[model samples]
Target chain A: MDLNLTILGCHSATPRANAFPTSQYLEINNRHFLIDCGEGTQRQMRKYKIGFSKINHIFISHLHGDHFFGLIGLISTFGILNREKPLHIYGPKGIKEVTILQLKLSKSWTKYDIIFHELSSKESEVIFEDEKVTVKTIPLDHRVYTNGFLFTEKPKLKKLHIEKIKQYDEIEKCDYNNLKSGKDFKLSSGEIIPNNQLTLEPDTPKSFAFCSDTSYKPDIVPIIKDVDVLYHEATFLKDREDLCEKTKHSTAEQAASIADQANAGKLIIGHYSSRYKDIAEFKKEAETVFSNVELAEAGKRYSINSYPIEILN
Target chain B: MDLNLTILGCHSATPRANAFPTSQYLEINNRHFLIDCGEGTQRQMRKYKIGFSKINHIFISHLHGDHFFGLIGLISTFGILNREKPLHIYGPKGIKEVTILQLKLSKSWTKYDIIFHELSSKESEVIFEDEKVTVKTIPLDHRVYTNGFLFTEKPKLKKLHIEKIKQYDEIEKCDYNNLKSGKDFKLSSGEIIPNNQLTLEPDTPKSFAFCSDTSYKPDIVPIIKDVDVLYHEATFLKDREDLCEKTKHSTAEQAASIADQANAGKLIIGHYSSRYKDIAEFKKEAETVFSNVELAEAGKRYSINSYPIEILN
Candidate 1:
């Protein structure tokens, strides 16, 4: 299974000369999903060469302008492109009303169906699921209602041991399907062959958690514990801890602490404040607590199974 | 008095790799106004180095997504920037409802006052007027309720003839103000000097008319007759006249015809459809009917007082 995450934009409040607000693209198990579209998300997607038609599912964390202001523009573009596939949008309550009103006023209805899944649960719940992966919500503490998303791949089938299977003459080629499904094979001699002896254990499922625009709260650590990769918002530096608390945002040190508490395999920090000109400081501050820390830059692709890959500027 | 127009984005329907939707910045008598903010307008403004604080008023032609989808994002950015000056928005009815609802849902109210001047008139009416300029709406024919805007500069004060004024010692420095106001001066010998002899005539009040997303309607010619510059939408070519008629859009020939009938000093054509790759064809088609024709390219600036100046790419 391949799990790739691409950073679209990572600035905090507003888009500036070289910085944009929060938005990302996650491709897990060949499924494409867009996360948190900011003001110029469509243009950013174009810049990154992300196909518009591939993203059928969009997850919006909150109603903040920096998070979802580009949604209407993207939707309108989809309409103009004459997309026929149904688009599914998952967001908090009131998102439907806001989007519908704009469409109504513009009188630009899409030919494709737009399905809205309004989420208002305080507890974590599964929002999307398929045979290959599952997506769940992570309720967070914020000035307004907000929710994070966690994507986890399903368990893989057992790998067949070719040499061990060849040792048994009675084990026919047709029995390989049963062996891979973790079932014992019955030999022609009326003897049972254990499944473990014929197959090797499969690789562990990979999981990724995305938490943004949330205050530092330890309660979410358990929900995202032991994830392969965790992306958390670090909107401020340690010197502005007071400002962070008042704005319901987290500092780089706080984000690192959450990753440390969760015991994540790797940590990616983003949503940097526009005031901070040097983004390398965020990685430096996060590395104090989390050993594996990476700064999320636009157009960079990070893989959960492999190390990060930086695209040429 | 200087009247300058900058093209921020000039494509129609959708934004593409090298094309953007409709957006323009107009500066008249030192006052700046934004016309038809499409998606990515703010970024385009930044790319052209247009100051955000300089735009105190924004005009929306209609409720189409390509025209006003960027308004909400621009407004939210103003809030984040901590703008204190009041911002005024003028558009057709239902625009206020759409903008206010999104702001309410996000709970991101601007610190600055946002005064919405909702317009829903079938006849031409003055929507905005100050000492320097006046803006009026030109009713247009479109699929939806739409209106074009006409910006006209107020008559400027007469220029003082310093050499001629110095000839008469009786003309005190304080009395020069009255002479500039088009009032004649009387000497002590009962000799009266006419205002025209003492001062040259002021530059003719410059005007600019913006018409877009509408079919060819000659009714607006009288409203914008003899304007310094006229920007009309040329969404299709002559070959796609059927498509233009069905979509309520205009061809290059039709737009030029309107400019020729209105007797505009200069005609600028924009809003090219994405299908047309070579924009020079639009200028070619329009020039067949009107000689003074220019293509509206992004980042290009057109001065009403002088000929068009092409900025190097």
Candidate 2:
């Protein structure tokens, strides 16, 4: 299974000359999930060729425009393309009202049915679960009601051991089915062989956590502990910690401290404040505490397999 | 008064590589009126550097996604910027549903109130009338219940008689004022002066008609008669007349026929079908009947004050 994330946008509240606002495309087991659709996201997706048809489920982190402005346009595009499949949206409480009003004023009624799961509480809950993955909300502290997402991959079947091939040759025909079902193998001499003797257990499932546009809150460590890849908001540097506190945002150091406390495998930071011209300082500050720190760039994709998170093209 | 139009996007359905769905920016006096905001319109506006904040009212042609997808994102931007002024939107019946749903899901409620004027009937009534201009709906025939818009500038003041300035300074001032107000002037020596003798009549009000994504309907001749500028849909060439009929679209020849019947000053045809790579044929076919025909290109601005719609920088 290929699990990866593509960064569509990474700017904060104000869109800069070259930077875009918050948006990310997460692909896990052939399914695509959109996170935080800021303004102009559809164009960015088009430029990057992220097919809108592939994205059926969308999750918005908060009520900020920089986080979810592009959602309505994306949904409208689906309508124009005559999409018949139902689109599911998970976000804060008022998103449905805003989308309905715009559609009403424009005289556009969607051809497809839209299902919305509005978030009102500040507690962790299992929001979406399927055969491949399960997603849970991580409560966050911000100006508005916001929540992060934790994506955990489901464990797969174990692989057959090659060393025990000859011993089970007599019952190999039936052993193939029995081994896959975790059953014991019976030989022609009436000797029983354990399933563990012929097969090895599958590796542990990998996980990723996304904490978008939230202030520094250590309370989320329990929910995001030991994630393989953790994406956290580093809106400001330590030098601007006062501004971070005033605006209810997280500094680079604060984000790094959270990753360290959670003991996550790797940390990825984004959503820089517009005040900073260069974001090198953010990475430098984050790396001081967390050794495996990666800065997010637009159009970059990170794939998570059995190995470490590898940045793809 | 300055009257001009900027073609932001012009296509029929979903946005393609070179063909963007319907959207046009109209400028009269100093205010900007956005018409038909298709998906990715905000990106187009930003790329072309059209002053977005100048737009106070938006008029959607219909509820089709290609017509008004960009509105929600634009409104969210206004909220993010903390704009205090309210925005007025005029369109068909279903627009409010789309907007309200998005707002409800994102939880980013708008700080500014949005006024929606929904149209369900095909009446040719004045929708908006201000000091400088008046906007009216021109009922149209299409696959959906759609209506075109007519923007007409108020008649300009009479030109000052520069040559007769020094001869009668006392009577000239009053004569010019009376001429501007469409009245006859009297001399101080008890002599009556004819309105035409002192000054010429004011220029007629310049009018622009927007006929988008509709079939060739000659029923609107009276509503758009003698318009100074007419923007009509030319979705296909002459050979694809059958396709135009089936799709409820207009060919280049058909769009020009409407301009000919309306006695319009000029015809600007756009919304080219994606099949045709060379759009010069559209202009060539339109020019066969309408002498003053121009092809509407994206990012090109057409000024109405000038006789021919000059492309602005």
Candidate 3:
């Protein structure tokens, strides 16, 4: 399974020249999941060559315009292009009303089915699960009802047993399928064959966590602990600590501090202020606390394998 | 007065790699006015080096996502930048609701005052005006309640009478300013200098009309008649006439026919379909009917002066 995450947008409430708002595309087990579609996100996705047809599920962290403004456009484009596949969207309660109102006003109703999962309260709820992965929610502290998402790969199956299977002529033929199915079987040689003898250990399950537009809170630590990749909002620098406090946002140092406390394998910071001409200051500030700090630039990709996260800068 | 029009986005509903959606920057008399802010419009404005601070008024044709998706992000950016100037927006009735709902959900209120003039009917009405130009709506046939805008320049002041101002002490001392201001004076010879003697005729006012997302309709001719430049949507080629009719859009030949009927001096076609690989087909199709046909490409500029419209291809 190739687990890759592409950063479509990395800015905060404000959009800058070269940077986009908050949006990301996660690919795992040949399935595409979109997280936080901000304004101009579809164009960014088009620029990055992400196929629109591949995106079936969308998870929105909150109702901030930077997180979901592009949803309407992407939805409308899907309608214009006459898509027939259903699109599943999970977000806060107000998202349905906003999306519905736009469609009603424009009289541009979609042809495909759109299933909306409106989340209202804070809970560690299991939202989605497939054969390869399971997703949950991590509560976040923000001015609004914000939450983060935790995607954890499911554990691999146990290996099969191979020894002592050739001794039986009648029983071995009958129970050979059971041995290959990772079951301990009684052979004709009067020996018990363990299920772990045939195959090696399965690969480790990789995980990714997305935390958006929130203040520094330690509550999410347990839910996102030791994740392979963690994307946290770093809206301001250390110098603008007062502004960060005033706006209920986190500075780069604070985001890095949370990543350190959560014991995250890699820390990816985004949602920068437009005032900063160069973002080197943010990486420098975060690297003081976290060793593996990657600035989440728009259009950049970060890969999370079983080994370690590598950034395509 | 400096009158320059920059095509920020030129493609129609279907998006392409290089061409953008429908958006244009109209610069006249040192003021910038944006027409139809499509998706990725802010980035397009930046690419053309149009100062965002100079834009004061925004006119939206309809509630289509491609026409106004970038508006919320642009407004949010203005708030983040702490802009003090007010932004005036003119659109259909639903626009205000959409904008206000997004702001409420994000919990991010704008710092500057925003004025919305919502249009409810298809009647032509003046939406914005300054010293040099006025913007009025020209209703058209579309799938939605869409309308086009006609930007006509106000007539220039009469030229100064420089010849008869040789002896008047108070008026002649001020040079050409006195004559252009239409100030009259009595000469030392006991004869009044008439205003008509030393002045030639003032030049004609230059105008530009923008018609977006409209089908073939001859009724729009009177509203945009005799304009210096006309930008009409040519969403399809001549071969796809039935598709244009079914989709409620216009083909290149239909757009050229409208320009011919309106007697516009220059015809600039845009809002192209993404299906066409080469845009030369559009120009060729339109030029067969209208001689002065030009294709509107992104980053292209059309300068409007007393002379003919000059396109910087």
Candidate 4:
């Protein structure tokens, strides 16, 4: 299975005319998720032609204004659109209080239920799970209580080998599920037919990790190891590495190092400080540590197998 | 002597890629004030090159999401920019609670002081006053406790009649103040020179009223009478006049009627619904009731004397 990650916004700090704050749209195993909705995210979503109605779940990294300032606005929009489906939001503990308070004040309460899964754990744990995907928190080191998320597609159901199954009339349609589950079928004569011959292996599940506004924490490598795509914040360059410590953010080189150490399939670095005029320099510096690195730009869609970014006009 | 009004955003309901919500940047008497900061206001400000730093005062008309969703984001950006000037915000009663709750959760406290002037009056009252201008509330008929803002420039000091002043060498710089204040100057010879002889007439003070998302309420005519410029919400066309009472929004014709009754110098109608494919139709509809009607567009500026809109490139 393939995973599609669309960058709605990737700029750091405040939102400018040209640069937007952090926000992204992700699709994995037919499930859509919104990550880190900063200010102007709704406009970006509209600009990129993202079917915002598809997103039922949102994963927020932190409570920082740049990361989640757009949450209330989006929620208010949902209310105006008369959305009836429940929206599940996962974020820091204070998210619920702040969001509810704004809705209370605006009196723009939505008919749809807003299910909040407040996060407080400092350790990695499964936060969302369904038949198609499982989402885990990647506890991050930031100024505020923050958590990155690991979205992993669940193993798909094995496909039926029609040719092999058709050869044996004894194997009824009811027995197809057992064979797909890797269970051997027993014929009427007591002879067992191996499930491998009747079923084809499904595609491998894909995983993506989103980590932004955090220090260079190498301990997260194990949890995100072998992820198909890794989105890490590279707020500064190697020349400004000292500022990273004080700001609790990572440099381009530092983000690349984490990608190299984790052995990730591909690294997507963004959340760049406005100080650097050229963002291409970030990729150049990151390449020194990790060869497979992609620069994140707003409206660019990154599909793991397709290395080139697909930009929305 | 002139009022420059820039439409930051002028669409109704939720923000879209082509349309923004209600927000405007007004410059009167050298004072910059932001009115109704809807979502993406900061981005619009940056796009229009509006000096956001000059906005020491913000006036929110209502607590609707489209009216003030961007307040927190703007506040946060000010904090990031390290603004030290005290910011003044005037809005509905619950604004202070909602804004404070968000800041508390994000911990993005500004070093500068935020003075909130919450309003709950049902009648027109002066909410803000300075030596140069005074801001008053225009009680409106909306779904919520909403109040529109009226900004009026204070009377300026009289200009000195250079030829007359030079003729009387006894009138020192000290006597100039008294003459400018419309007081007769008494010379050392015990002769009084009338103030009219020493000073010329000053330009007439201008006033602008911003009324958004209100039903056709003729009662507000007296409050905004003779204003140099008036911005009123025309969320629907005359075709949807029946919806006005229920939605508490005005049609283009209705907005024009109010402006016509108030004897306003000019009328700018906006907050158009997305249902209308062509906003030009709104202008055509409004022209039936009022002659001087300007269609509001984001980034387009209206300076009363200029008559024509100065669109930012």
Candidate 5:
């Protein structure tokens, strides 16, 4: 199983010729999810060769246009493509009304089921859980009601040591399932084999945190602490710290501070403001506070397991 | 006073990597207006070098997501840019509710005034009028409540014959204004010069009819009859005629039929279906019915006054 994050867009406020607003595609435990679909997200997905049918879940952080304007277009496109699979969407409360109104006015009732999980809770809560992954919401402080999502892979079953298991002929294939579940193996000859001796624990579960468009509040550090990968928004530089405070956005320094406090394995900073002509300054600013900082570029993919080892900038 | 049309996007249904949905910018008599702002329209405008401040009026054809999805993003961008001028949006009745709800949820009240003129009348009515242009709505036949806009440049002032006016020394610069307004010049010697002899008629007031996402209805022919330029939606080819009828969309041949019946000066067909890999087929199909036909391409500009002479393929 692979845990990967693909940056569809990373600019802030408005979309430009080369830079787009916030949108990302996350692939975890063989499940695909779209996060914060900004305007022109579908085009970005096409440009990155991400198939539309693979995305069954979409998570929106807030009601800002840049964060969710592309949602209606994507839903309409899904309808055009005649998608039959039910699509799940998790977001703040007003999303259902906005999507329904647009669909009603256009008379484009989709053929697929659109299950909306509207959230207004201020506390961290699990929003989705399946066999492979569990998704939770991290309450964020912003001008409007917003929440960041935390995706964590469920703990894997212990892998069976083939050589050790084969030595016990009494342990059949049926009994091996029990050993893989972290149970001791009992022999007919009254010999007990320890669970650790029979099997080795699987790799630790991977976790990813996506926090964007929020102020530099340390309250979320506890919720996103120890995540394998953390993507925090760096909308402004230190020079524009005044604007960042006024707009409730974070600077590169603030993002790095959050990552450092959370002890994240890797830190990726994006959501760059169009005012800054050079992006190198952002990297320099964040590197001063955090050593393992990566710049989020569009169409670039980052693996959570490849921590400390940079993928692409 | 130039009447020009810039194709911001022309594809139908979904936006692709290279093809965009329906969006167009019309410059008529020094006034700029946006027609059917689909997704990625602002980026398209930037790509074509159309300034955001230049557009004060936006006319939406219907409530379809592709037609109006970009409107909210553009409004948000204007707010981000600190636009002070009031922006006017004219669309179907439900547009106001949809736009207002999104803004309220985001708490992004724009600094500029957004005045929405919602139209519901089935009869053709003047929805917008200024000193230079008058926009009328042509009720269209579609699955939902839809209307196409007819942008007509107000009758221009007669051009002054500089050589003829110079010969009369008694004609002052201030008096030339009266002659341009179609008033006969009265000399101090009591000699009256006829308006036609002193000035030439301004280039016949140019008109452009944009009929999109509508079925093949001949009734609109009278409303858009003999227009300088007609852009009709041809969402399908002859092979998909049945699908067109079922979806209330038009084929290339049907679009050309409407142009021929209206005796349009020139015809441009767009809103291409994503299913068609080759666009030349649409041109070949429409040319069989109307000789002066062109395919609408993204970023292409069409001059209404330059009929019969193709600007770009």
Candidate 6:
């Protein structure tokens, strides 16, 4: 399992010279996905060396400017770059209308086709699927209609125990694929070799969940249970818990509580309000609730496949 | 006369690390105006220490994404900051529709009013005027419906010659405002002191013209003649003069030709295409025809009021 996540911008409310809004780049199973592009996301992508052509799919959490304001700009740049492939965008309803209107007014209709998938479902359902990965939506409670995305790698085919298979002469090279498919090996002597004994179990698939700008919603834990990595919004600390309810945000303690309830392997918390002077306090408070916690910083990359969660700045 | 210009972003197409798109902060006669906000204009404003509240008016040159993609983000930030004063936006006919659509979809309606002044004129016309400054649209030839802007400070009140007034005690302090209005003072003896003799002529009013994303339209020389400063888009050098016609852009030599014909005090050329390796070439080529030329660089401030044109990094 190989998965890498880059935090582009994580600050909340407004963008400052030092503080950017929420945007991230995720790479899993050699597939690239951009989540929640804020105002400076493209610059951040350039800073982080994320190629523009690598991304064919973009997932927007909601219609908030902090989450998706850079979509139109990025799309226009693709036109300037002469991208020929069609781009797919998934977001809340009305996304296509707003995007198309800007394009029409600018008279910058891209030669490349734009495929929009507007999601209005309230229930958690799979929205994207391929041979390698599947993406599901985790409906969240927020001021606006929003959804968190869960990305999971599909299960791998069974691996054959080459040394054990060599012991049986009946197991020819032509039957290797069938044996790898977890079928029992039948011999001409009317004897049967169990599939489990002939093949060892493959490595477990990895999963990542991204949730942001939502209040304390316990129901999401069930949808993202046992996720290898969970990135949640922690806009404030426990001291400002009272503001969380009104703002429809979550505190660091609340984010960690959700991570603990879901038994996530690791938790990354971000979307800090600009009012906070220190982000270390978020980590200190979240650690008390969940043992494994990491603070999301701009330009930081987290690799959960490595033991102890390898982080690169 | 005090006029300061800050180059926020002056690149032609997409924004790069060091090259911004097209955005400038102009301070003329104590009025702040933002011109052509590209994708990262707000961040550049923060870098240049331009206060968000200081800007009351924003002017867009055209509907190109690089020219005005940052408008929605800046407007949304104003909402998050709880700005109470109404924001005035001046641009093309579709500016209001595109901006309002984004705000509406975000559900982040601002408490402050957004006064949009949409322009659809093909001739030079005054769009905004107050006591100190006047802004007029300079129609340009572009691929789309585009317009340049000319900002000029109104002629100031005449200065009161204290020494000359002391020579004639009949010129009472109460009559000072009347004299400042360029009115001749009438003595009780029926002898009139000529207005020019009573007050020295005030410093010549300063003017700045912003022309971008346009081809060589020499017809505008009469409209902006004797302008103190001219900021023109030189997207290509003389070597790529062929592209200017097809792309509806101007070369360095063409920009210099316009400045020379208009008799501008200073010529600032920007909006350089990314293909050029060095921006110094723009200044070199422009200076061949125009004596005083400056290359636009991000974070540089040019003050034309001072001798030799004060440039601060």
TM-score of each: 0.96, 0.86, 0.93, 0.95, 0.97, 0.96
Q: Relative to the true structure, how large is the alpha-carbon lDDT of every model?
A: 0.90, 0.82, 0.83, 0.90, 0.91, 0.92
Candidate 2 on A143-167: residue-level lDDT in tens?
A: 7889899988787567788777665
Model 5 misplacement above 4 A: A307-313, B310-313
What residue pairs are clashing in model 6? none
**Which regions in candidate 2 have their CA more than 4 angstroms from the true location?**
A14-19, A79-86, A93-115, A161-168, A171-186, A190-203, A238-247, A273-275, A306-308, B16-19, B94-113, B167-204, B236-247, B272-292
Error of 4 at B39 (Å): 1.0
Q: Is the docking of candidate 6 incorrect, acceptable, medium or high quality?
A: medium
lDDT of residue B286 for candidate 2:
92
Consecutive 10-residue window with the lowest summed lDDT within model 6 chain B: B303-312
lDDT pick, better of 4 and 6: 6
lDDT for residue B211 in candidate 5, whole number 0-100: 95
Best of the candidates, lDDT: 6
Pick by lDDT: 1 or 4, better one: 4
RMSD of 6: 2.0
Residue pairs in collision within model 1? none
Which regions of candidate 1 are displaced past 4 Å? A162-176, A307-313, B307-313
Error of 6 at B62 (Å): 0.8
Instruction: Give the Å shift of residue B131 in candidate 4.
Output: 1.2
Provide interface RMSD per model, one decimal: 1.4, 4.0, 1.8, 0.9, 0.7, 1.0
- Provide chain B TM-scores across all predictions: 0.96, 0.90, 0.94, 0.95, 0.97, 0.95
User: How good is model 6 by TM-score?
Assistant: 0.96
- The worst-scoring run of ten residues by lDDT in candidate 2 chain B lies at B165-174
Clashing pairs in 4: none
List pairs with backbone clashes in candidate 5. Answer: none
